[model samples]
Target: RIAWLKNYAGIDYMVPDPQNPHARVINPVLLNITQGPPNVQPRPRQNLNILDHGQWRHLVVGVTALSHANKPSVTPVKVLSDKITKIYSDIRQFAKIA
Candidate 1:
């Protein structure tokens, strides 16, 4: 699958907060897709897409928060999809040479 992210200005990324040194963000805003013949139960935490649009937008609070809130979590899926696509392409190339 393919996905995309549209930054219409006023969006920000996660950064280190000096005031709250221990308040680290543990959640990743990406969908972790896994591939295997040995499908494990319960799966890895990284293999799940848990963030909703609202939660995702809240990652960067600002005057343009509404813009973010309306947008879906596309970064993670897009990134993961690109990686998977490259893997498949590599496999295909290998098969052609073999």
Candidate 2:
């Protein structure tokens, strides 16, 4: 599961919490529930034809197959904010070199 996330989502670290020795801290952007708009209903499983091949297949399959039941839950808003902050920081760093 950790390897799958690292390979497909570019998430290399799962921070360990000393306070909760059993918990693994993964970025919430990796969750299926955080991937789409809040107002829009998820496409039915029967309609996900795009997952059958190509890059989407790799990502979708890996994410869905991972065992998330034991992971801590995070609000979608928090996930969005974290993702935005990461992107902004990345862009700033890239701009410095280019």
Candidate 3:
């Protein structure tokens, strides 16, 4: 679940705009991880794991006869399987953030 990102994590970046010759080039020093932010609630260790990998979400749909035209002829079990497959495709689209 771990990956390297510019040496460390937490969305670090540096701008090298030469227009400002006197600008600071060094990284900022911060307090140790044990330090607390006075305003925000303390995050759980599970949150750090989320940073390592994107979150997974699942959506499920149950088949019903209301949407079907051949309710009497089509088996409810087969309808459910088709509905589940469509749900999976929807999930894939959602994962793409479209």
Candidate of highest TM-score: 3
- Candidate 2, residue 61: CA error in Å? 18
Per-residue CA lDDT of model 3 for 1-98, tens digit only, reads 01221222221233233567666342222212234554565664443222122332211221233223224476766665665565556555545442
- In the range 1-98, model 2's lDDT, one tens digit per residue, is 56755653445456555579899776444444455555565664334333234644454444433423223375544544454454446455544442
In order, what lDDT does every prediction score? 0.38, 0.48, 0.38
Q: Please give the RMSD to the true structure for each candidate, in Å.
A: 14.1, 12.9, 19.8
**The 10-residue segment with the lowest total lDDT in model 2:** 63-72
Candidate 1 per-residue lDDT, tens place, 69-89, comes to 333464544544444454446
What is the lDDT, from 0 to 100, of the residue 51 in candidate 1? 33
Comparing 1 with 2 on TM-score, the higher-scoring candidate is 2
Global CA lDDT computed for model 3: 0.38
Clashes of each: 1, 0, 0
- Worst 10-residue stretch by lDDT in candidate 1? 1-10
Q: Which number leads on lDDT?
A: 2
Give candidate 3 regions above 4 Å deviation: 1-63, 96-98
**Once superposed on the true structure, which residue ranges of model 2 sit more than 4 Å away at CA?**
1-4, 7-72, 96-98
- What TM-score goes with each of the models? 0.22, 0.28, 0.29
